[model samples]
Target: MNLVTPPEHPFAQFVRILGKGKRGARNLSREEARDAMGMLLDGKVEESQLGAFLMLLRHKEESAEEMAGFTEAVRARLQTPAIAVDLDWPSYAGKKRHLPWFLLAAKALANSGVRILLHGGGAHTAGRLYSEQLLETLDIRLCRDWQQVEKALDQQQLAFIPLGDWMPPLQHMIDLRNILGLRSPIHSLARILNPLNARCGLQSIFHPGYQAVHREASQLLGDTAVVIKGEGGEIEINPDASSHLYGTANGVNWDEEWPALAAMRHVKPASLIPEHLLACWRGEASDAYGQLAIISTMALALRGLGEPRDTAINRAEALWASRHQVART
Candidate 1:
């Protein structure tokens, strides 16, 4: 008997049945994961079936092999641009609470000659505008075409691609999350997919629970990446001085000495986060904290900015300090 055979109906039919709770909650084999992802990415899966598939996968939780297989299917569908930069940052959902700092990080990296590609979609909620909106606030427009992105990278060392253009199917999956009012497996997958040929990426996750999922996903990637626990899901290092875990292609590194809030002698309360400071950072007005956050995250990135840890940190501090003079001017 041939053990390997396609399902009797369309793959979407099988997906709909599997998603409808017909199949007991169980881990998907590697092949099953690949086929499901392929159908979703190709737009062959119906909206209802899509929701079911996503929810089921979330409950079952993706294993490393399953994630790798699913990502491989996603990678196959994405039109990755050939850029020379080694690092790309893919920001995830939710950024309403804290000041958006990834823009500053991207700008600083661009200013320092690191080719950075940033990508994300618009606000799923009324209160939360996304990184793309924040970038627009800074006069940075999203580049929809691969050639245009390459041109921007060659000229300014930075480019932003909107999800609707860079990966529509993935965006479609993300849209479903909003409708369901629950995050799906695509949320995790989106954070890990690097759409550039570059071999290194910087990814940030907001929830601690997802850290292991990111780690497992990163192993499927051919390039080196650092997974950071970020503020409001943006990749900027936490300004509250929380311990951050940095997972690279080789292994994981933890910052043990990160200052805790209670230990700090002088710290601003979350209620006291200055609006003028945020506006200035957002370019709606001029303020200092935004500038400080930008400088600090840039320094952090520079410390591990593709060099030996010590050298990167030393250089990052020096570079950060140098910006203070400009802030005065």
Candidate 2:
């Protein structure tokens, strides 16, 4: 019997580099990570190799530079419309405890004529409601492609591009959640992807530690971004708890604290009917918690777009108050 050994794969090399014994294993350099991620996104890596690379990276906890590299590959491959987008909003984390209050915030921003490109994917884990699943109930534009994103922006000024529709390979990595039994590095990288090279970005994470990670990577990527530990981990503020906000604008870095909006702690709604999101938007429902969360989230987006704190907060409140009463078209 004659058996030729299979050629060593570049991805396998990458896996070995990261998975080498404790002392031997080290994080990949920016360039190395960029190459690895580029290969993964292009479907050049074998499935088994892909799984190993993702798990290894996740276990090591990616560095800011590594995150920057992975995000670089993702941003390059995105199909963006020609339209000018003022904001980049990524909403990967699904709503586990609250309805998506940030969707209303995006809507209010759009009503005020701020063109936003909101992108995300979620519900890879059970018992969660992602933006894609609930945004439709409000009739918010859920674009299937860059063309639809363009049209939605032209018509509505706010649009969402679900990860699966915009970047299937990345979504495939995310979809591996069930098999992997843990989140992969793609979650953080996907949230940092400013696909259209927008002027500003808004990000939220469940962990407080990633604030610096996201801010540094955004700085390296040469854009302004605001990050916080949002409610239910979905870029929506927690009215019941103060938020630690971190970001950078221009050449300056920022670390600030935003006080909670609701006076008292809130209990998760007994049941979440997606319709409540729309009702709140339409002025038919007025839960103080939902209202404050929406306004605070909008203010964060405005701050990312270069508004001063007081101005952003004030403008967000005004925008929320004056939003259209009619349902989304």
Candidate 3:
């Protein structure tokens, strides 16, 4: 009997294509990226290949085409329910310096009748407060599956799906942070994965160049999205600093600069208390920084929904003022 050697693994081509050399390496085309990500998500790739592929992409700083393709692959694998969702909120970047005030903004929007879908990779990074851990405290439903997501949306107008529940492989990649010593491209791709096909996608990026990449990728996917350099990399605007908004509207891309909410910078809290979110909502506490963050974040969402800048600010303020009535209803 003669022994025969197997051919190269199909996934190896992608890794090779990316790792060829500094001059030879190039970003994957949309189709190739889709195929590569599909293999990764399906667990068809080898363990070594997964690490190599991720780090290669990380080194190259994934292009808009690559991100759009990765997002396409993830969305294809998603079992999204037929729910009317107005916004797709991806909160993978956990908050460290500030409390996740964006959660309150999202809740208020849901209360005002905007159906939203929020998703995140759980608390993979230590010393950070993830939305997954605080959803229950905020009274937002954390759904485990499509059925639960549908029900939550029908009842609460908002639902949060943890990445582990929808796509375990991506969550696993995020969890490899400590071992890898650097975050993989999953963090970037997850933000653009609007699995539910919502009308608007809100994404936050902390790194300097990623905002444009996210904005362009969403445009490539024909998604109306808003990208902001939010507080602590979560999708909450800092009241003390001006925010630049990169977004797509009606197939056209646009950029805008939002003035800071406060005339002067305010000191950050020494520690974050989750209950403050609930207390503020219940009118039991008043925090200027937190309140401005919520209102400004809501304004960004409203702008993504086609409201003019000034109108969005005004509407956000009105919504914040009337939140108690909306919460009761």
Candidate 4:
């Protein structure tokens, strides 16, 4: 007869560090958080302790140290091949009000020879249409693995990988939303992971208050990024609303506000159709609102990638005007 020995709970100590009440509980230092997250990604922690540890981090806001450490651990677990990427665009936010205008912008940039790596997850929240849902409509395939991501980029300069494929533990953590009835820290960590360590990263928040925290955390990760209070918390700029962009530009911190390109219009469209994005890209759709949204978002991305503001704007406009998706095909 053989007896099964229980696995040691390696994460219990870190959980205790954060779970103790006011006097005893303290935030994990970068190193401690790194160790804990490493254990999490390595499958070293038990399920019960994992839930407790996640909630504890969520209860008290995640610090810059924690975010940095967690991301560092994630990168360590990934065996990413050497892939040159011009931009890291992450989209986990689902859009209820509008089609993803940013998708068009990303493709347009790719059309202009920019290599973009778009990664995201879906349905952390129920009832909203996420980015992955629009792939078929856009004629872009969802990369099932890292090799596919590289191949897609090589063939078209644009590729999208879901978070579930990029990192399974993160996907599992994000899935806990349905279980815990609240978002765990992975939601924040997923957004900030520029897996390729790209030169430019794009992020946004729904709540205006988290703007500062996201900005500072991006800085802490030592990855160049641009953060904004984007439409429905996505990186798509609302052409009708002024967008304040916060991040490191040219290795220097920047806080710049881009004024609205059009007047406020509160009327929601009758439908949210993904095909319109394809139409807009192919010059078959004449939506003033949609076009402005795409151009402004592309301009923001170019700026984050080190283009001067004026040059970014001019190039973005030119890229928009010269779009020939239909003509090329």
Which candidate number would show the highest lDDT if scored against the true structure?
3
Candidate 1 vs candidate 2: which has greater TM-score?
Answer: 2
Q: lDDT per residue, candidate 3, 1-329, as tens digits?
A: 99999999999999999999988899999999999999999999998899899898889899999998998899888776687889999998888888999999998898898889999998888999999889879889989898999898888889999989989999999988788889999998888888888999999999999999999999998999999998888888998998999999677999999989899998888998999889999999999999999999999999989999899989999998887565532
lDDT score for candidate 2 against the true structure: 0.85
CA deviation > 4 Å runs, candidate 1? 1-8, 12-24, 250-292, 308-310, 321-329
Q: Ranking by TM-score, best first? A: 3, 2, 4, 1
Better model by TM-score: candidate 1 vs candidate 4: 4
TM-score of 2: 0.95
Please report the TM-score between candidate 4 and the true structure: 0.92
RMSD of each: 5.5, 2.2, 1.6, 3.3
Cα-based TM-score, every candidate:
0.80, 0.95, 0.96, 0.92
In model 4, what are the clashing residue pairs, if there are any? none
Error of 4 at 288 (Å): 2.5
Encode model 4's per-residue lDDT on 73-159: one tens digit a residue.
998888899999989998888888877889888888888888889888777787677888888888666898889988988888889
- Ranked by lDDT from best down, the candidates are 3, 2, 4, 1
lDDT of 2 by residue, 1-329 (tens): 99999988767878998999899999888888888989998989999998888898888888899998888887777666577899888888888678889888888888888888988876788888888787768777988888998898888888888888878999999999899889998998887888887888888878767888889988888888888888887888887889888888785788888887887898789877788888888878788788888988888888888788789999888888888842343
As for lDDT, the candidate ahead, 3 or 4, is 3
Q: What is the lDDT of residue 71 in candidate 1?
A: 78
